[model samples]
Target chain A: MLERSHIQSTGFRNVGPVGERTGFELRLRQANYRGTRLSLIEGVTITVDGVLYPAAHNLVRIGSRVYTPAELDAATETRLAVGEYMTVIVPRPGGLAPGVHWVESAIGYRHPYFPPAHQSAVARDARHATIVMA
Target chain B: MTGFRYGVSLYSYTDDLGTVMTLDDAFDHVADTGATGLEILGETSVPLYPEPPAAWLDHWFAQLERYQLEPTNFACWVDTRIQLDRKLTVAEGAEQIALDLRLAHRLGFKFIRPKFGVIDYNLTPDPIWEGAVERNLDLAQALGIIILPEIHAPTPIHHPVTEGYIAFIERTGTRNFGLMLDTGIFQDRPLTAWGGGDIEAIRKDAPDMVNGIKVPVEHLDDIIRYVPFIQAKFHHVDEDLHDHQIPWERIVPRLKALGYAGYLSSEYEGVRDPWVAIEQVRRQHALIRRLEAEWEAQHA
Candidate 1:
């Protein structure tokens, strides 16, 4: 079975003052438990209050490389090794209210064993605290 | 009839990681279920690997004593080729295994379930696994810990790797090495929670792929003696306390007949919500208890 474990979101806070574009950082570790190197077609998606944010955004940073949606989606080969961790960072800008908000992130990929079928791994962080003016 | 004991692995509560239940909460849940044993992932459950703070160790033992739970298996990672660029040397791999063994010993766990670096989706052990494990046999014996490579799903019980492991044990006569049989191998049907609606439809849709791998129930008799621990791997348990996927009815009785007394640690890998998963674990323990009693009565 393909597995991803130890997924978490860290360094989440209000990026700017109350009336400005607000966002938080998402950090997650993705490992390929499926023996062979599996291609990670699209990195991940962050959902905030029912809104979907793809990992292809220009603000998304996976390791040292930053990519826009088109660039991340267009890149042909991104294979993850059996035990290697691919730390991901997603920067979302805009419309984050004060107090608590629900945040969820998911990664979708294809493995060779199950050809033509996509597998998705998801992690959610509830009680993400935000300050009105910090 | 074998006196089988029920336990809960912290991995069962994976869905609630750092959100709903902390490690302490998992202990309370296991204790509440009257499970006498507990298993934990070394990297995830332990605060620090190779070395935990004195205070954390104190609190850990206190919880174990307070809840009266025995430590069973310390799940560890044997990463030999996880590196994206290069593979670690045999020494490096052996070192990782030894470190975990020492940690397991210090934590009072006699068994360790190590996930070796696999070479295929079928979980064939990496070629270096044999050498690495061979190097650490002495350390394992000295530490009084048994290293059990998990024979999990999609990897058949009769696979070459499994045969090789059994051969290694026979050749070396090392009691420190054995297998941890995951119940996923006995899954009879595709999990409805994972595969929507019709199991056949899902199988048909994914023609070349398998939903669950099934090993003949009777075949377990051949290997049960080599297995000291069993991962009661379940994807879903219905409201009626029946697991529709795995053939627990047949498998449990087979183990009982073999007099296979080992820890059946609940490992719920369902797609259900966290709270539901917790309840499913409790249900699994109840089912195990019921089956054990039934087996005892029939045999007597």
Candidate 2:
């Protein structure tokens, strides 16, 4: 079962190696009431400790596949169903000093059903998550 | 006199379904309200959707039998704008409906509400909707189902969008198609909290959606014959049994006057604060049932 909030706390960690960390990743449960095709997700922006990482710089991983912002616009076969979460990979060399940090995510969604002006909806969430290991 | 049938759409439990509440918990909540019908979203409520495991299917029937609720409407999506650059063709749309029709039959649902994607802000469905639905008339009839596209708010009962639907029913003379009334259209007051989506942006771009379109209740008399089900969409009902948004007082009388004996499925789009919908749904049932009782007393 996923958490109630859009931003999940369990999947918060740094990737690559101990000394030469490549980046950090966090999970986000789909915020919409219904699951959307991957193409419908415009982008997901990540911000940590006030440092910003725009949606373009973040790569989303759903299941075993990773997708860029442009790829997400064309990937129609993939779906993040209700109660499912995807990990947002933000590239930041040497990650963060192993500790608790304030993290936020802004996910842009293009729902064709919504009116033209309101089609691009952004779901934002912020919370404190701990990176246990360096 | 025949009174209205009461039910609840699983949509009322939007945020809490997967978090704090389970499917069993939802059944308990609705049955406790004395509602005899249960409405569910095909994609949202059905695990694995189009193809749930046999075990889940067994569990679904078991839940229905135990809760003493009958399946009402199977809510679905046409997704006309399937991708950013492309839209689904009429054939694809027909296939979508056919798939849901079969699934709804398996789940013992009488109605399927396919929310077709819109062409513009007026929420006019794509042109392919007609052709798509035209092809599924036989299948819907065979399965004993009615395809109901909701007459929701911001899109009033008199708009060209609704006229198009009525025209289709008149032109084809098919009993398998009808309009599902979403009571939100008759909302005469402003909504404080919208449970659907981004509220502030909706208020700025489409004020009619948030501020209410205020379609008159008398309009129900215009097309009540074409309507067989109503989604009781409401935002808030206070501790004192007062609905702050939708005006059921005017609407209920019109429905009763029309001799409509269909389900009033609670479609709660309100504050997503966990269990607030449970009590709000109960309040709506109480308030609407009281109005029905009052109408019966007057006539009898």
Q: Report, for all candidates in order, the number of backbone clashes.
A: 1, 0
Question: lDDT by residue for model 2 over A22-84, one digit each (tens)?
Answer: 999999998888767788898999999999999988999998999998889888756777878
At residue A122, candidate 2 shows an lDDT of: 93
Model 2, range B1-300, lDDT digits (tens) per residue? 888999999999998887788888999999999999999998887877788789999999999999999999999988777767889899999999999999999999999999888878889888889999999999999999999988987799899999999999999999999999999998888878989876887778888988899999988889999999999999999988889989988888888999989999999999998899999999999999999999888999
How does residue B299 of candidate 1 score in lDDT?
Answer: 80
lDDT of 1 at B39: 94
Q: Deviation in angstroms for B232 in model 2? A: 0.3
Question: Quality of candidate 1's docking, in CAPRI categories?
Answer: incorrect
Q: What is the TM-score of each candidate against the true structure?
A: 0.75, 0.97
lDDT of each: 0.68, 0.90
Q: Which residue ranges in model 2 land beyond 4 Å of their true spot?
A: none
